[model samples]
Target: MQAAKKPVTFYLGEEVAMLKLQDLKAEAQSSWETLNLLDGTELTAEAFQVVMRKFGDLRHRSTWERICIQLEALWLLKGLENCDLIRTLAAPDTPIAQAYPAELLDAVLAHPSGLAQVKNGLQQLYSDPLTESDRICAMQFLKRISGYETIDLDLPEISLQAA
Candidate 1:
């Protein structure tokens, strides 16, 4: 495949971050290639830590949209192991936090503990702006993964009263 033609630029106020956007792109490419060749099912703690750190850093950057676009292009998850990305980024107030929250919810939904965790998180998003965003995401997850439906039943019966 051809390399991306446009270069990613950042608005730096002081000392630039250690990892460049291109570096993260390279990591994604490497991950894609690795997953295609000899994909492993388990996430090593070191690697996990590295990925988490990158994501944590990403959440705080002003270049979040660009970075997330690159990541989305690069992150073609191989299996449950790669679900870590989705899990970690599912919640929190960040540009990339809401990026692909629902994309791999199915992976966790398949696991009992993971599913419970997601359910609890959904419940906890009560009144914040992110709540509606996250709730929409959770609803979408249920809909796509299964033929499930989300209903808002304020009153027990279907009373078609005009507001």
Candidate 2:
């Protein structure tokens, strides 16, 4: 018999969203794989060039940083399951190199716009019917930009489980 599934919850203040962890994991993995395949899974030179060209505007720094942070978290969360595959796709020199300003990241994390963008982006990715890869990229993009310390670790154990 199949094992009982684990429940996943995302809580924001009084709001709570529920889902199956197993299903979410599967979707995340599929999305990562698709992204890797599309870009040759190597973060190749061409890929980096493309990324730099596309995200060259420093004016949108907040958006860029938020996306990166989300992506990093998603990578950490989902990549842990398939170490080898994740490693290959997440080479160090990717276009998502250290682009966010330290000061900006701090400000964004502390500001409402940063949090709202991340929350909205995640909600859209989770709810939309897009391929897992697009979702993974979207999350990765957010993670790369948002400040690391912004992730509240002081929350109860249950609160940390969903994200």
Candidate 3:
């Protein structure tokens, strides 16, 4: 696919640094292309290394935080109902929950331990149960519990899906 072209001019103090900006952009594009060529596992490992250095932590928490940040970006880009979707998945009484298969609903509903705990507890809950989108919702809910400031729930109404 052809990359979209837009005029990007960077102003540095008193001068327009067009040539330097072009060089930087070219370097970034080359790096991105190289990364895109890696297999999934290799890419994930590389990403973990990058995040470990970026956060200055070797713990899993930093990697999880970075994942949540990416998920939040995806939600915002897709115009998902961040607040309502999170609430619906967490609360069993919501109308959306009413549409879920009864057992699946019970298994996937948010618990204090979070979605990972709920998934781990169920042995037979993996047959077309939760969509990838659904998992994303559950993940955001889980993250919000521990890192409440990470996901911005107070976005303007235009970005939110109707409940």
Best by TM-score: 1
In model 3, where do residues sit more than 4 Å from their true spots?
1-43, 60-79, 86-163
Give the CA lDDT, 0 to 100, for residue 97 in model 1.
25
Better of 2 and 3 by lDDT: 2
- Each candidate's root-mean-square deviation in Å? 14.4, 18.4, 19.9
For model 2, how does the per-residue alpha-carbon lDDT over 24-131 read when each residue is reduced to its tens digit?
333334444545655467645565445434534524544344445444444433343322222222222222222223432354345434444444445444345267
Per-residue lDDT for 1-163 in model 3, tens only?
9996653332212223222333433333333334444323344556644643654443454333333333222222233233343444344332112222232233334223333333432211222225555545554545534556454332222312226
TM-score list, all predictions = 0.27, 0.25, 0.20
| C-alpha positional error of residue 121 in candidate 1 after TM-score superposition, expressed in Å | 1.7
Which candidate number would show the highest lDDT if scored against the true structure? 1
Instruction: Name the runs in model 2 displaced over 4 angstroms.
Output: 1-97, 101-103, 138-163
In candidate 3, what residue range of length 10 has the lowest lDDT sum?
120-129
lDDT agreement of model 2 with the native: 0.39
Q: Go through the candidates in order and give each one's C-alpha lDDT.
A: 0.41, 0.39, 0.36
- Which pairs clash in model 3? none
**By lDDT: ranked, best first:** 1, 2, 3
- Global lDDT for candidate 3? 0.36
